[model samples]
Target: MNDHITTPITPDLLRGALELERTEHGLAPHRLPVRARAQGDGQLAMAEAQPSGVRVVFRTRAGVVELDTLRTRVGYRGMPLRPDGVYDLLVDGELVAQASTTGGKVLLLDMATGTAETRPGPVGTVRFDGLADRVKDVEIWLPHTEITELVALRTDAPVEAVPAGERRVWLHHGSSISHGSNAASPSTTWAALAAARGGVDLVNLGFGGSAMLDPFTARAMRDTPADLISVKIGINLVNADVMRLRAFGPAVHGFLDTIRDGHPTTPLLVVSPILCPIHEDTPGPGAVDMEDGSMRFRATGDPAERAAGKLTLTVIRTELARIVAQRSVDDPNLTYLDGLDLYGDADHADLPLPDRLHPDAATHRRIAERFAEAVFSPEGAFAPQPVTA
Candidate 1:
């Protein structure tokens, strides 16, 4: 008989989630708080529930660990089924094992109709054994693309919460790219990788298809305690085509103002969208192109719409730069980073986006490396400030 001790899943053992909801089976970690979720639409609800950056973290001497979870995975009605969500186990901050559980629920989506169907399934377990019998920090990075509910956690030895170290808390909000769209695993996402390199605790708010500048989201960020903050804007706004240029500028300002209300001196970085060819000069209401059973996306709005205040990648970038410059007069901690510097036309030629929408796994790593160099290095904007008396 396998002897293991069952430990209740508690908030202290979780990282990167804004709130935890008590579910019938166990607990579901939500990236957005309850208030924000209530105001968000179905897209935001699904994105936040995906747990892009959430993890189960603790310290243990156990040689074997098992986690029972109920995961809700997304799928398209006609597109090829996505691969099972991956669970990455890290021992002492190094990826030690990667596992996945089967038989969880599936939410099949209809791309053209914007509707979805849920198929219920039973809970499954992910097990990782053969760890060296020594005390070490362990983190199980939940699948970034799945809605995972923690049912139970078991280990051969006792587990305890890891001490809060001196690492800075990085709270970032952005679009699906920041939400680990095509990243292989949770820990590999560009934001997650950048957080690891920066030696910071990541609180990711990169909701897929849901990075709209909502007031509630800003309030949540304002209330959340963090040493560093960043918001990647433009892409989602352009693709969704929800707001025009007339409304975009004020929305950006309002978003930053709200964040400053709570974190007046914290370093804030405003990043524009990366190089997206179709949406660079053209407006959007981006549409799906299911060509030959392969999924692709394209900007469908007319380019001339720019004359009427329609937003585009290029327009958004110029506005964001101007906004940051205007705000920096009094907010010295505010900074702007052009997304093209992270991924530009040159990059597209070398590492084209697989879906023409989201970056591939390798690109995610590349973005993370670039971001670390630009924001976390000694000379970077987010580098530690000097003390003065």
Candidate 2:
């Protein structure tokens, strides 16, 4: 006879064990958190999931709420949460959902009623349903004033996965115009529309009131991953009057250099500002009239200053082209696209920008179409290499 020994399991030993296991027989959904800028407000919708046979346990600063059955056919929208504190969700006590609203917006969900709301002030809560199993805890993350938390979460189930293969990634950075400023939907943003037209993934780094040649943003772009990249500059800088020509040249160089550090020979495109009559040749103390959509210009620099061929859009665009040409001599993959190429005098003449500034939705579509044609067409400006067997 052989003696058998049995090992005893203790709660402490299993306490650290990951108990949540997603299997074909059961379901566990992934949850995403929303983030909003300080004094900024917005909403976030959840990624559609297998609504049938799932339950959601949502947690917010307000408290925890359990949602009933979710509708599989229709995608669910999340409740609104403000940027008061960290927000999070847990399934079986394993942290699977998290988000922060430092200075931006955060959206949570309540699937039962199919209603979504934005959180007021700096903190809020939301809940969802269709969790296949039990949940243990929820969590939230609030880092700082500069972070905007917007996330898309889903429960694990039999959902169609994004096709895998050689995927095309579009990396873009620009000013508020590219940041979905007045666009009706996120997908309607010119950059987003362009990405869809080209069938490429997008990494949008468009920042409102913050595209003033920050080295940190350049560093961020340099470190990020992408198959194609473009930077929309000049408009914000000109409007802000943050730098003169003396500083602008070096800044452009530095910004591109930073991105080149990582992208190296990637298809990088630099874009100048669109046509703005007020700021085209005139120096700004730019003012916007919401009532009449007319812009009033205050002279920030002497007309003689610009008369010397400095601090004008023409000068900036020329300098940008020069720098890119010089750099492209060594890095053939780099390129530059004039903003006017997308929405020049003719296009603008027809679809004049509503406020004498930002393009309206129709103009956005035109710009998107032009960009797609230029960047994605077979003979487009930034076409991919022909694959060789």
Candidate 3:
């Protein structure tokens, strides 16, 4: 019985050892070549690799300027204005692009088109044109008096890979409210807040004025990876009147069915629209003036159309809950959440939506607090249930 055995080293054991070593001594460093630059008259200029391709540059002067390239628009709230100034973009420290403005507002840039425009106004597209394939390195320069913040910068880098572990991803889709509308900061958006509270990673697909149950958006949600998901629908549909009741139900089912293709057993929650009296039981599209007490109601359809239960917010909320209820019998992991539960009649009375449509910063914080308690807490509603026979 004098036999000897040898243990084979497995990949997992090797990886564990490597990780332990890294944690103890830190990562090995690589030497970077250094370069010298010309210095003159108390000024020092350094030479670094010029970043290739078109990139946005942001600087400050007297007033404030913000650049947002994302789907959502930027808001300056209100800031003091300075004299006329030219905001310029330089390539290799040479002037190549510019936006002329009177200062004190949000500015938008479209690097793809090399165009710049002001916002809380018209939407514009920017194209880089003939320099698309040949351009590298970009810089932004503002006059010596304005203050600025770079909200977003376009990038072409490949997305980083997910870390190895039992990952849980939360996918949320909604309208402008979820798109950080009127929120004080990007990190303060309700979706971002909820994600932080719930301790889960998120892929926010909120699109302002673009969550109208489009087939493409549905397909995108269907294909995206998720461990848990929720869709805050209805308000945008009601405001837009994109479809009638007859079509709305089927669209909702289709949307859910598409998502189920990828996340069959994942926990899914369907939410209704929060209370907005303007569209509660009203029909068609309308706009209200916040400055004055003026209302513009469109006669897109007759009163009977509303009576027949078209795309009213109330009707959609009721039907969405019903659909999810019925579906839950077969798919136990599915659930329904009344959006008003986050900011019900009581909360609304205190923190009313500023524009009579979207919630302001204070209201957003309130909703995030309630949502964390209700859905994200350990003993909250979304907690996993015990398996049954």
Candidate 4:
């Protein structure tokens, strides 16, 4: 009935990815490779496939564009409902329109009962009509919060993959804060914002609740192509209450060592946890304080635990600074960034973290602005080098 050229989506059109695997219905873009997926923790395996900053990019003169996606959505049975993920369409690098699929698949979990269920949905399509006839670069940003599979791509005019240009690739990994916990959309995530401001291509490894310096993560970073890299550590360490002081230092060292094996001279920045007042001096296994329907985080570990080598933000910062200082003696490219520089007490007074853990949208913007200024400045660690002919 209709006569539009429908093109099959393939890896060539995708950006900010390390590997792409063909799925039964579509293509699954992964931040980590198959080998890394097989060896990493279940959380890492799940998080790496979410396509945080990944997008489908191409150059075209199409007057209309349509995208078909198979999204796997997540829902909490008894908790607050998660909003539908957003897809950003950028025309020549500027946001033009936003889209989200209606239905594909849903994974529901009954948090109170510890039961979970999966429901199959349908493929949904988003179309943007009346594009200018001139050739322009188009990017369809995938939802950072959803696990999406690319089904197909259609355009009225022919499309071609755009070869990467001068922009450097930024590979970053961290906790929920880095994962865009409360960020509104994929492109608006702090990492993406910082990348935009810094004029770099982002490969965000900011996996929610899975930034625990796993060797698999480090190896994945090692293998991925990146010009600059950063690892934000500590919050997950403190909140997950996973390691003791005895193991924390070695774990940090081992994680860095694995990355160094692959990126011996790449600009590698080690960032300590941001200012979290509750866990400033206190230890944690953060717990939820469900008051009415609102959920807030509370540090459950004791302050005295620090004396026993339990990790805290203050303690972690001191150790991370020490590690970078010592390593920089031999590896000049290594650098350290105090996470507080991104979000600290003074700024928190003005823009407080709404949930006592994750920053709200406004805070995310502020942090991204600060990150861009601080890390991309001329003297900054990841500053862009002037390109030469």
- C-alpha lDDT of candidate 3 relative to the true structure: 0.53
Which tens-of-lDDT digit does each residue in 193-303 have in candidate 1? Answer: 999988889999999998899999999999999999999998889999999999999999999999999999999999999999989999999988888888799999999
Worst 10 residues of 3 by lDDT: 42-51
Which tens-of-lDDT digit does each residue in 123-196 have in candidate 2? 22234333444323332221111122222223232222222234576777777677654454445668867876
TM values, all candidates: 0.98, 0.61, 0.58, 0.96
lDDT ranking from best to worst?
A: 1, 4, 2, 3
Per-model lDDT: 0.93, 0.54, 0.53, 0.86
Error of 2 at 52 (Å): 30
* lDDT at position 187, candidate 1: 96
lDDT of 1 at 386: 69
Better of 1 and 3 by lDDT: 1
Give the least accurate 10-residue stretch of model 2, judged by summed lDDT.
9-18
Which runs in model 3 stand beyond 4 Å of their true positions? Answer: 1-167, 288-304, 379-381, 384-389
Q: Candidate 4's error at 24, in angstroms?
A: 1.9
Instruction: Report lDDT (Cα) of residue 330, candidate 2.
Output: 88
Which portions of model 1 miss their true places by more than 4 Å?
385-389
> Per-residue lDDT tens digits of candidate 3, residues 1-389?
01212122122211101111111212211001121111111111100111011123322121122332111222222223222333445443455555543323445443345454565432222222222233343333322122222222222321111233333567777776775556654345677567657756555656555567656556666766677788889877877677888899999999888888878988888878888767777766654332433223232434467767678777888899899988999998788888889887888889877777888778878777877788876666466444589
Native-vs-model 2 lDDT? 0.54
For model 2, the stretches where C-alpha displacement exceeds 4 angstroms are 1-166, 292-302, 307-310, 385-389
